[model samples]
Target: MYTEHPGSCSTTGAIGLERTRFFPRQLITPDDLIQDQIYFRDKLRRHNRLLHGWGVVCGARIKPGTGECEIVIEPGYILGPYGDEIYIDQEVTVNLCQQGTDGNAISPCSDMTDPWCSNIRVDRQSNKPYYLAVRYAECQTRPVRVVGTSCGCNEIECEYSRIRDSYAIKLLSELPSTYADPMPQPNLDDVARCTPDHACPACPTEPWVILADITLGAGSKVTKEGIDCFAHRRHVVSFANYYYLCKSTTLPVVRSIFPGNGINLNNDQALLREWAQRPLLKITFDREMAMPKLSEPDAWLRFWQLRSDDNLTVVRRIFLALSPENPPATDESGFTATYQLRAGAQELFQSRFLIQIRATADTITDTTTPPNLLDADFSGTKLSSEQLNQVWNVTDQTTLSIEILNNLSTTDATLPSGDRAAGGQFHSWFAVLG
Candidate 1:
């Protein structure tokens, strides 16, 4: 229903006039009125989704909550997965440390044992990762008092208004709450797609973009210690290209955790920049060693794509030549010897895309030895557009191959010329508009 093009007017042809026609003296029932109104409403939503894509269009910012495990969502507008519009015209609060689905307070689990988290829809406490996302919803409003019939069935019914267009802020797990499923893999196309819990109240299958990756320290109970003290969140990104907000790899954007945990991700992948009603994605990072004993990697890339669906940020074709934040490292020869540089792993994507390769340091110095030209030296060349196109332009390519020749220095004459390469670059591209 979402994949069709918006160029044709027939998209709303699901209902014909013949279905709504009433002959002279024909009576129109309330059912007909409701049906026609709902049909047109749904059509309009689908049309919006088909044309403009989805995500925050204006001012819905996140801020810290006054209570424990609470987050405040500022007023804003957004287009949901089904193209439904969610308008948060006022501020609202959501408790991240939720233990129930009814939006009611429940005593935190003391031991924190939840086995059926994945089988049925249940929230679990984990020290790992959870995503903060939002969706569209609505409820009863502006009640009109009406006299009850002889029967008391109208106690909960006969409401004047039933508005159904509001935003829902929630914390969700990308993976099912169960242990049977393997680790969820990052979508090569859409970062929001995941092996989610089908029964999730947060609409697992709906088009909801991630805002951030939230982590809770072990044994955090809302009834006891506060989430403000235990929860941590972050949003990370690398250089997508010079056109991006953060053009340089050396200084990729990093929105670290704050008191309110307001950071945006997965929403700025579109050509249009964020102003108001902006959706967001949050993440966390744990840097690793670049080389066996060498220092951490200093360069990386934040590759991405621009498409019709702003809510869906696909995994662009990336060349994994290094771990810009912290590439993996290993020692081959031994101590006091040249550290073996392991070239980055081959990157794979399911598209024909361009890549950026950056390398630095024309020479290497071994201070351990006395002057006079020591042993090892490193050599590298910055990647050119033509060079990247040689592999990226291939009509049938998924995996990116890395070259170890010039990027590495075969030093340590004392040890055999071990295969060494230092090509660590950043991984994914999820830009944030300042």
Candidate 2:
């Protein structure tokens, strides 16, 4: 019904009479409906009623594939106050309601539900256009008498004169009581206050208020009274790597409660003794406060003086080594020697490694060449970042087999006096006595 125009021509019988029809005679009739026999006219009336309520009417557009079909029912009406002689450029508010099966618009008139509009579907298919059906009571009431004129005349001029000249068929001099009152806005202050600090509208006491200086290894100070302050959160205490939240008063209490909360030894010797065998070391301090505050960069620098530790402990020279076979220290005579060098354990944070190969000379007879000082030859061999950890242990008891060659230009090495051993460099293979 929406697709076909009224003035499309059709051909007929052998006489060949071609005539124009205002509407397609092949429209879907109520008889074609599955259930109701009289649903078509009712649906059309509902469509017209909704259109009028919204200041709109249905307009048909010809489909491209075939001239007989209509694409959609377009809105053809405009909104303006009577006698205003105005040009409207904006959409008018619509009054919407749910559509019943009988094609009538229904509104909420009961106490159970409040006034609200729903989308009215003209057809069940997903692709079809639907109307937002607003109820009559929901729309604003205005007193104006208007008459529609013929379609062929200038619509704008005809509509203007009809609205300006017509008499009112219905009359109500006074405005409705409900219409005069201003709409009330909902209170939002309570809602704003109800939100948790971490949620929307964050409260001042929210936990985890991101602090710039609370990075790893940072610690705070506490005063005798209760002033808990932090130094520059910028300090990267090798022990930890996160930011610190400090309190002046609680720190002293925590220190007293847990004496070993941080490094305690006042002497380097004692510290060394305790940490000699330890592989990795970490130190953390208690800086919990009753109420923690944000520690911005400027704020931390401003409070640096108050939290500075005057007698700060320093980490002296520390040696680290990992050798599965660390040989004993020796003299030039290849003599077995005793070593006191501390074999330090690898720390957790270290990425590289250190290896030492100590050899003791026992048999040094000082003969001819005296086994050229075993020089570790580091020549061509693919070595990468991962292979840097490799270590070779060469002790006094280790043996080496050397083979020197002289190139004779020919393949035969033992041919004759003129064909001396093929000349080439000597190859030495080092191995343990075992």
Candidate 3:
């Protein structure tokens, strides 16, 4: 049998006697451990409360003779609010001051002739204070009148009104670097594979067949809105070359060994040389006349290629030009002109590929002035490698047709009325076997 003692060993054995004689320890009970935990928890709570406290002040004021009021805020040693919650990064600060009509200092409360609001708060990052001031006024309240008539025929009237509008501040996170700095834009000049020279092709590396060369004789007249001026041409290609230029034996192939009979390499050499003579198309905008108006008229030059089956491919380009005269009035009214390129129904390139002139006018007030010349050069490669590949992959021997549609419309209500004459040359090319 074992008996328990409060402070000593109850067993009367040599082992118990040895333990009691050699080792001594202080006893801690469950209650004591629980008390220690509570003490530490309270200390942590007090420390946290000291670190985070109400650190922002808000102020409000009315704008004199106006219905609007501005709210001011000052931050203390704490992070500013992001949305409804506070953020840790404290890089921003608010500045506010009260100024008189002549830009002189004025008392925030009494010296201010106009309503004013001022407040201060500290920033969490620098642990510095910031001040803010805002003007406020009521915008949408109407006065109510009360009238009383006494028995003696005397009337009394009273009006009731008060400024009850208020404004609050909301902070949003800054945009990420990826959005702040975007990728470089593509340029038409960089992508254009063809030029205007009829003697030389723009892309000498690629085989080309001359399809059509139509000289716009006298230039078409464009006057009314939504009206279209057009030029059209027809072309055709052989079936074998259209379907199997790469696989056809008639086209030369580089052989590893010369045949014992000897082979003529002129055809193969000619095929490669044909790259220099690839076909090209060019359009020129010549004379333009305008009737001075408050607004400017927009014009579009559209080019389309059609196959025998009526499949249509659209080509787009943008041209930008500035006014040549540099008038003072024109300077006050900034001007911009652009011609954009599209594929089928989608617009792929815009301001980047434009042919920019020295001057751009959004509104044409002087119609009598001579029109500025706008020129743009384009190549099949401008369609992008993927788009060009899609065109080359067509299997059918189709009648290649081309058309240019010129249109003009008003972009603004005050656009000037105008009659413009435009003339240009059109050239189309196809891949062919030499």
User: In terms of TM-score, which candidate is strongest?
Assistant: 1
lDDT of 2 at 239: 23
lDDT of 2 by residue, 146-265 (tens): 455444433232322111111100011222222212324335576456655523221112101000111111111111222111221111113233567642221101111101211222
Error of 3 at 20 (Å): 94
Ranking by TM-score: 1, 3, 2
Higher-lDDT candidate of 2 and 3: 3
Worst 10 residues of 1 by lDDT: 251-260
Task: Please say which candidate is ahead in lDDT: 1 or 3.
Answer: 1
lDDT tens readout by residue for model 3, 200-258: 21211111111111111111111122111111111111133345343221211111111
Q: What is the lDDT of candidate 1?
A: 0.37
Between 1 and 2, whose TM-score is larger? 1
lDDT for 374 in candidate 2 is 15
